[model samples]
Target: MAKPRIFEKPMGVRDFLPEFVSKKKWVEKQVEDCFRSWGYREVITPTLEYFDTVGKASAIEEEKLFKLLDGQGRTLVLRPDQTTPISRVVSTLMKEEPFPIRLCYHSNVFRAQEREAGRNAEFFQSGVELVGDHSPEADAEVVALAVEAMKACGVQNIQVAVGHIRLLNALLEHVVQEPEMIAKLKQSLGRRNLVEFRESVQSLNGSDKKQMVLSLLTMKGGQERLDQLAKMDGGKQVAEEVTHLKAMWHALEDWGVASRVVLDLSLVGSLDYYTGVYFEGYGSEGYYLLSGGRYDRLLEQFDRPASARGFALKTDRLVMASTQGPDHPERVALVYSRNMRYEAFQIANRMRRQGKAVSLFVKESDRSFDSLAGYDRVEEVIGDGNL
Candidate 1:
């Protein structure tokens, strides 16, 4: 490789400035507090895990993982997602704990991203995981919390679309006998490629079943839409899944987040581990803010039999959408002569104790008050005890 310039950083990574970081932290705190209010405690996990464990089990693609070898030559991976590592903790460390554990986290996850405009190799994510609950109520709870979290971040115009994977899977499996072909069509849906999906449908010999499946993306709305779908030819095949979604909708209604939600059968989740109801939240201008779904089979991979559901907010994106950040904390600058250094320290500490951020700068002969542009207030102290 050629010698890199000093200004260059690795592809897909980012450097957040102070202003951006302030907003990011604000968003993270809002989400954490919201998670806590719902009785979900926070937990921390290692950033690196054995490649055979979380690396392979994470919802991220294998090629997108940042893999390396430790001193022992065992392959290790920077965590690409939180779900797998949290599952590992639940199965091992929290094994003795009872079911229905509610945990939340704010962590930096790394996934190898290409030279793309909108992708980040390392980013911040904040979310919660509810384990050992298979009820649609659990699904509804996560969705509702997602709404509340966004509201806490001051992200307006939020729309959360919920879907049942079984409905899509059943319809595809019924029409396309081959699993690979069905997977191909699903890949198209996961990519949100309506044209490609229609093309894939047309390639399936133009059957009535293919046409019905083709309409799944447009099969989105509220109870009336659900009712319409439940009466469709293919919807009857997924009667149980439809019933699950209906129960979830009713639960969300009780939570009062139903107005911010829309039913979209096409949401296959961003991760494959999502085996049941899945959803994604969008901010204004179609910004993908967060995603979560039920992953009942994930905990089983770690030798623990339990159901789990969770969501992760793209913290960086939320920061971008946030119009407000923590004000500069009421800065106060303390200026003093060289002989009054000790007194300046005392005064600065006093101001800090009074809940203001304080900084001390020597009143040098060459210095101007203009140098303290960011300070909200400035006070100069003299050796004679004058302010």
Candidate 2:
């Protein structure tokens, strides 16, 4: 029989090598510490859920999901986003737990699209959700958590751009009460196209509110610009959301982290679920490092509706932004003599217990100690005698 060819991995997917593992774990630890301190208990959901179940409230368009059949001949698919599965867990599994469930999760998500510099078809995300509350303070807390998480990872030269979905929602309410009009406006917002948006509003005879909305599309930097915007808009919901956004902004100011924030009212999220404040973080590379917002209606689909807000930072991009190519942490090496094979295992276990990176190397017939140079550190010799 002829041998079958071994094809390369599909594009947009990657395998993490040992050198990347150390830094990846370091990033996870930072996120875990930040989330735990904020009272968010960690939870996990399966990597694959029934195609329909995971896609029910997913942000991914139906056409973009990667699907397959399970052993039982049932349709199944990889999760496209973490929050939806987490929401399902809270709603269906832990329904009676309590109000304002503070849950955190770290998982891989898959989609079926060609990834580019700013996009990925498969990626890792770490985030927390605060369910059952809708206060501006809760919103601020989520935003702050994202900022703190990035800072923990040694990330700098980044800005968290904040916006309110309500502002655009309100404008849609005023201009095009038609479903078609709303959908078209959403499409424009997703692309951030000022020209098309202007023509669309003009077609609807939108003058005052349209102009205001268009102006928001151009407000792209700093707090003073956001304050100027808040003073212009007025309406019950618009005014309330503005008040909430300002409060959140001032909270950032109080934390002395306001310099790293930018107000972007036109920053519409691609997800259909975000019904309140929306945000995305960008580094100097001009790429989104993290993206999330308020999805208050997400849990309701699972029959346990509640006000919820949170954000997820893309861990892979985080590694890219925070670690320079040559500076990524190297793997560890543990070398031992023939008589100390068992001791080598003991030492590696002890180092792991103390949260240190470790890899064991038992004495071999051919390779010399010079091979240890490949790793960041090495335990040269386990003494012949035990303590």
Candidate 3:
């Protein structure tokens, strides 16, 4: 006899049983309601796109992109992020539709991750993009929308920390003389490694400029410190950026979301594409739940020169941060014969209409009790003795 063969699921992947499916549906509905409440219309885009298009503003460190060749022998890959595809759609397909397009989406993203991260290769994301407007109000709108989404999840302890790329860029453009030094500084900032950033700055010939850059890194958190940093020498342009940030801060407060907002100048987004204001929502437990920012130049590559802004909430992280006891209450299960399947389903439907969780399973044998016993909070099991 041939040896028996065994098949196993791949690592970092798991099946979603019925209970998990119900939880996922509840979470998705909450996100959808929050987005629609803000007048954001739902939109869908293909999960795969030309590799060149998706690669434009990619910040994925591990390039574990699932790349393949299309029928035309052109490179195509699964989309690692949604913003770029949506930008392409707005620029090419939705051009002449409307200004400041308010669009929302919920979909899966694939990423190649190292084992230590313990994250899935495929995960879900829900976010909204507000394009065609560049104003403090628009920035605040996106941030507020994220806050509302979190609240809709029954999550209360989240803070939105905001920053601006222009603030850092203004300082860099004036301080760094050599192109190589600027690149090194950008990498350091992206990693949030202040020590490396200081060392790289010191390697430069000028002390005054290096010191200024180092000091800027230290001047973080809240508006007062930002104002003080603005007064430093060679910091006038940075000061103007501060003014812009202050305006955005005020707008967030005016929208009544200031209590949930924080100013973290030291905060650096992992992605390099953000060109202006950047913000991330963090759970009270210190987990990053959502992130987004402005990237006006991103769409320029597609010949669409328009102001664009958006943010994405990690569905896995969101679910982890907001999980609670079962969302639905315990209910009765009705077991019946194959001949009574339709009648049992009708009875289950009526109970469901009364807002109950009713499970109708055919009794396979006397062991059905053992199987049903595995389900926690099973209030009662109703069945005929047909078995």
What residue runs in model 2 are displaced by over 4 Å at the alpha carbon?
A: 1-4, 114-120, 175-182, 198-210, 221-230, 323-387
Top candidate when judged by lDDT against the true structure: 1
Q: Ranking by TM-score, best first?
A: 1, 3, 2
- Tell me each candidate's RMSD, in Å, in order: 2.0, 4.4, 3.9
- Judging by TM-score, tell me the better candidate of 1 and 3: 1
**How accurate locally is residue 381 in candidate 2, as Cα lDDT from 0 to 100?**
58
Candidate 2 structure quality by residue, lDDT tens digits, 1-387: 655467556656777896577677778888899899889999989888887777867877887788888888988878888888988898888888888789999888998875554456788889988898878778878888888888888786878988888876765665456778777877887888767877876776547656655665677776677576566645566667767778878877777777887888778886477998899887767757898889988888888878998898988878777743234434578777778877777777777787777877777788777867777777655485342
Query: Pairs clashing in candidate 3?
Result: none
Off by over 4 Å in 1: 116-118, 175-180, 205-207, 235-237, 383-385
lDDT of 1 by residue, 11-121 (tens): 987787987877787888888889999999999999999999999888899999999999999999998989889999999999999989999999999988777666888
Top candidate when judged by TM-score against the true structure:
1
Model 3 global lDDT (CA atoms, 0 to 1)? 0.78
Q: Between 1 and 2, whose lDDT is larger?
A: 1
By TM-score, the better pick of 1 and 2 is 1
